[model samples]
Target: MKKLIMSKTLIFLFVFSFINVFIKFFGGSNTLIGVTVVTAMLMFLERDLTIEPIKNTFKLLGINVFLGVLSFLAVQNIGLGVVANFTALFVVGYLFTYDLKRPMYIAFGLQYLFMVGSPVSANEFPVRLLSLAFGALCIMIPQFLVNKNKLEKSSKKIFISTSEDILTKIRNIKENKNIEEINLKIENNINSLKKMLYDNRKDEFYLNDSAIDILNMGLSLERISLILDNYYDKKMNNNASDLNNKNQEICLDIMESEIKKLKLYIEKEELIEYDINLDEIEDINLCEFYIVLNNIHDYFDEYKKRKNTKSEKLYTGNLQIPSNFKISNIHMRGLSKESIRFSYAIKVALAGAISGFIMDYFNLSEGRWIMFTIFSVIQPYSENCIIKSKKRIQGTLVGGTMIFILFSIIKDPSARGIIIVLAGYLGSYTTDYRDSMIFNTMSAIGSAAMIGSVSILFINRILFVLLGIAIGLVVNKFILPYDIKKGYKYLVDMYERVNLEMIEEINLCIKSKHNNYKMKNLLLVPGLIEDRMSLMGINDKEQKHFIKEQKHLTSSIYNLYVNIATNKIKDNDFNEMLKESNCISECEEVKDVIIDSIKNTEDIGTKVACKNLLQILNSLNNKEQKITV
Candidate 1:
């Protein structure tokens, strides 16, 4: 409840209302309108009200708004309106189309362009932009007054929490417990940590390097746990011998001790040396128990080195704006299917055009309401459209009823003003609460009712909202509807980019002379692949296989980092293997060969796994061969 009141959204509403009321008192409607223009423009520019400034906010706003006004003027040409609007949508779509990057400002511009029945008068554009720039400054003022270092501090806590969770899981494994629940918890923490890393980077905080190290460490720990789990399962087999039991106990003891040392090292922020003796452990080859132990040892050794290393200052630079914005990244997606942005742009433009035509033909008053409704309610997915449709209806009903009742009793100007203020507060406070749209709508209509003709406005608003929703539904269903395949393909395209970036970061970090070279592209390939697979469902065998290979590749990348950290890659044999390449079918083949070699007490299994790991590294670095796909 307390957090709700302090939330930036609520604060923004308060500031807007306070400024609007103040301006209304001094300069009346002209000033109030100017303030509204500024507030609305700035609010749209700010997608999430984080302290970080938008990338090229001023530049993007200038270009988009200028183009929007031009487009709006073209739309006033009776015969050319639909064609102009359609052309504007495609142009905006193409201009902003970067692979995996959504340009929300383009959408914002379209909304502004179609805001009224005609283009805002030529003279009003400059005044409105000046007001908007002032509003943007006002919004940023509070950001400076308050300390936003909480993001940095909280992110560090999240990173620490992730490490603690992993340690708990390892300790639980020692008690012979079911680790599935703990595994889920660790996964959740890791995801939260990833979000923090991105958030910190977005804020341009100095803790980015530390966050990356923590994330990498957490992933390495997870890989180590998997190794332990596999070894534990093999040792606990029904055909297990006394030799397996002895070896299992020794490995468990070694792991438990090393994990304790790791926890100590993390907590104290100091180095801790540890060693495991495979020569001392009897029958090390009986179950390949030594291999898992060796990996864990390498991980711990690497963790210590990475933790002690003081990283160089990360690159903190201003965002760049391209001189030309016409390039389309859709072709880079390497898909025959049209990009979703292109498809969605067409859907929105077509639906909006049809709505405008219907309104113009009927000679409806305030036809701008129809365009606003279509812009607000139409969505990328059918399910989203349905949900938004329900919300719109509920909001309209609440707003209309509130206005009707308020206008009947409130005749005194001063009394109505008080009511408006109170209603605004209630609406703003509950905007994020249950029936948020309803409260927001109620506030808007109720405020208008206090000063203007309520009955007509109420009826028009509700009618247009319903009409827009209906048109949006028809267009989405009959036009290019939601295509999960296309969405999956797009996600895969994004994953490929992320994968390449992650590998490149690792490559740079390894080669850099700087002791503290932070990895810039920390892509969560596993999570991304999971999302893609979920969209494709169980029927996509090729995507499934690709996801599996990618997971192995990601794990191998981390494990190779661990190997490099431990100086294991310095070994002549390992160095030679890292330089070689093999066309491996899958990680499973390598795993199978490893298991067979272990059963036969041969080095082939270990060699196969090492070769496969190197192959993934090579594939990622050399995009010419591109994962043999």
Candidate 2:
């Protein structure tokens, strides 16, 4: 909270200071203030103020600064005509290096168009660009510093806590003289470490190489824990207390040896650098095992509940639920089919053009242009977007009224300076809540002041703004509209990609000659599964059903693939087992079931096929017990 407040304060100060400097250098003009306010608001909106790694933030800052300087110099030398197109090309090229090429390219194109047609003069272009750069820097710097400090502090604490926990578990093992207790503690620690590692996946913050290396070390510790558990279990069954003592000592020795090996691996691999080897991650299938274990535990718990108690209603079986449905009175809503047809770029561009045309028709282009610009990117289906738009419109009206009254009271340059300062404060405050009204109000006041300075009537400014918002709202509701289908298609495409990748990995595992090679491939399945599940919540019933069916099939395939990979690793021929157990037939049945589920639109067919596939896969793989829940 302190960090967020500090970051906001720093940004506010930076913008205010930069505006002051600009006003000093070039007498405050309405056009200049309007440009400044717009650019500052854009920077605040675009900047990701979330806690992130210092290195990444610094890297982004350096890149943005370089790009800004390049853009400015390009405009200076090549003129606006050449720089306009080239600036877009450069932003696109930069984005290509980051795998977000498509969206960034579209953004660059729109920004290029906006810059080219903007009323701001060529003489003020450099200053405007610098203002934008300064705004970006303000947000990035404080956020970077605070996040780095917090991560460093947090990493140290987690390390100490984890180490202490491990040591305590070992001490308990030594004192209890009971292997089962020690085994359970070690398992618990492994589970905790697995959760930690999984949580860190795709995280944008905390780039601590040591913390990541320690996680890798935990994988080795897990292996040691498994070995110790096996040893203890064997000794206990044999009733060999003397042997048990020796085995416990042996377990400790083995654990020490493994820890030394892990330490050497970390040192030799230079794992402390944040560049983790994707191949190395493949070797630990801890996440996959964690999911399987968790599911099985849940299944057993439900089974126990069923066995222990009699309910008023007898077990009828699993409740059947369709993934997708449309209900009209229950506030039924879906993506506008028209909106889905166009990408975000097209939607924004169209919205801007339509809104501008409406204002132009009404002879209120200037006020409406601002409204159009704000709503262009605001998604139609989004509640947040609606809220922001309404707030922005109201803000503009209030700000315009304020500017009219203020201009009547204070005609001096110093009063204008104070108004500028107040506008800066309002702008900064808006960034904190993302309240569009405050932002719109600030822009409106700034715009009115700019127009008023040029001898335009204050009443006319207010009327123009109202006219603009009216057109903007009309365009938003009627023009193209927002659609949910696009999102559904996106989810479907992602699902397909994940399945394709899984198939590719499984094929690679099957063909690999080495024993441990397949283990790495097995590890990736869980993360892919997790990604799919996360998308499920955001989808409609039809989409959800499709995802569920895909998940069921994928899970079965993963289990089969794991069993095959394990057998190959142990240098055991599983052909006899495969043939006797009807594995091939079961695989074919599972494939057919999935294909049928995909073809059939009805919920019943899909659910039944999914259940059948799950059952067959479970029956075929005796190593993996069937989940009865």
Candidate 3:
């Protein structure tokens, strides 16, 4: 509750600060309009409100200001509007090379082109661009400060709580004599640790090489927890009839006491470190530990099996690419030069057309400025287009509405100043909430207020904005429909890519002396398998067949790897087993026989042969079975 209140307060403060800055620097009635539009755009794009956004916004603002000044000077002899628009477009293209930061750069570029590039007088462009740049800086600085402060607070709490939890869990494991209870507690703790690791690892600042190491450690702990749980459960079941033994009860009491001590240590808010000595547990039953160690060893062996299989998949590199570039391509797919060029061309054409129409309708005289906005801001097809479209529409409607309302309310020139101050407050709140609708509405109201105060007094301005939204929605839905089939294909392709990569990794593991590589590859198998299974619901028959074959091959290889790793058999021993069992040979032979048998119109001959091979492979022990490849 306190955190929520604090967050809201910071938002309001930022909005208030932005409005004040805008009025002080720009003073035009439309200053609020610009703020609202930019704010709405920010909300639409930034879902998580991470620190990266605040930093990126400021960096973009600085770049825009520098470029705007330069362009203004260049166009002093020519026309300021033309130079500003050109500069904005060029900067947008250059800065947008960093994928996530593209939106802000585009937003600034458009703001400059539309708001400043108009009234193409050579004298007015520099002042307008400077005002625009200053307005952006006002909003960006406060946003950055607020976000950075929030991140710092959140990080401190997360780490402290996580560390305490880990220590408490460790102590519980030390105390419990029932073993089953201890194991359960340990498993729970490990799960908690894994979740924390996942959260931290996802955070941009936390994504480092150490993050992967932490994840692996978390997994190892989880494995240990599981082993301990199983061992205790088995022992407790066998000794259930002898529950009244005093010595057993005493040992249990001691374990419970130790767990309490560990909890106390954790709660003390001091780091506790200790070296674990397994040999010191000579007095207590050693059977449980032995069982746990044995299981851990076995788990590692099984992991290697999965790893080897994955490496093989990665080496093959047989993943299929989508046929349709525009509809089917994903961001993960490496873009070809042709595709990039095509995107650039489409963007330029679309922007030119859209801007031309808007200018012709509004009779704003600076129609070319609209082209700058469209070209600079529009994302490529590879980005998540559906989300972007929704955001864009929402921001425009909301900003437009706000501008209209503010203009109507602030009819008197004297009250306009106060209303502008109020608009700033509203902008901050909208930006903080990161809602496209609210931000756009606020921006629209502000812009209308700035543009002739009497314009808002006219009641039909709201209708015009709504009409614009309707048109935009129609364009988005029908003109270039977002295809779900294409999205599914992209997912299928990603699965294939991951699978093929895993196969390659497996091949490397086979040749390498280090077994860790094999284990790492195996860990990736279940995730890929699960992904493929999920994609099956969304994919076509051909994709399903491809996934099925890949799954079968990987699963077979996984079993073979497991047999070799767990039993510690020689390569020759594995080869001999594979030869004797003839699993691979039989599978191939069955395929050939099935094909020939189908041609011959023979009844059950192919089926019988396939069934016989399956039965033999199923019955054969790992030691006796052999693989051909």
Candidate 1 ranges with C-alpha deviation above 4 Å: 5-14, 17-55, 71-119, 134-155, 171-185, 192-215, 221-268, 272-337, 357-363, 412-434, 484-522, 525-553, 561-567, 570-629
Tens digit of lDDT per residue, candidate 2, span 1-629?
Answer: 79977887887676556556655654453234434343533443333344334544464455444544444443233244244334433343333211111122333333333333343456766665655445345445554454333422443344334434444444555554564444444444444443343323223222223333333344434433432333444444556478656656555543444334333432343222122232222111222323232322333334334334632122133422112211231112222243232323334444444443444345443534443344433452334345555665566566656666676677786777677566656566455333545445545555456545523544555555455455545555665555444444554565555554554544444564322322322233333333433433453566445544454444445454544554422212223223343324445444443444423423322232233334434543533344321
User: What tens-digit string does per-residue lDDT give for candidate 3 at 1-629?
Assistant: 68866886786666556556666665564453355445643453332333355555565567656655654453343344344444455445444432112233445444544443333455556666666555555455545554433422443343344434434443444343544344334434443443333223222223223333333433433333332333344344556445433444444344345334433443453333434453334212222223223333344334344444542122223322223222234332323332332333334333434544555456643334235324423444433344444554455555555555665565766576566555555454444222644554454345445555434422333444344434434433443332445444555555555544444443333443223333443333333333433433544566545544444343333333333333333334223433444234343444444334323422222222222233323323222443310
TM-score of 1: 0.68
**TM-score for each candidate, following the candidate numbering:** 0.68, 0.47, 0.47
Model 1 CA lDDT for position 602: 35
Question: In model 3, how large is the Cα lDDT of residue 347?
Answer: 41
| Candidate with best lDDT | 1
lDDT of each candidate versus the true structure: 0.53, 0.42, 0.41
Q: Please give the lDDT score for candidate 1.
A: 0.53
Candidates 1 and 3: which is better by lDDT?
1
Q: In candidate 1, what residue range of length 10 has the lowest lDDT sum?
A: 321-330
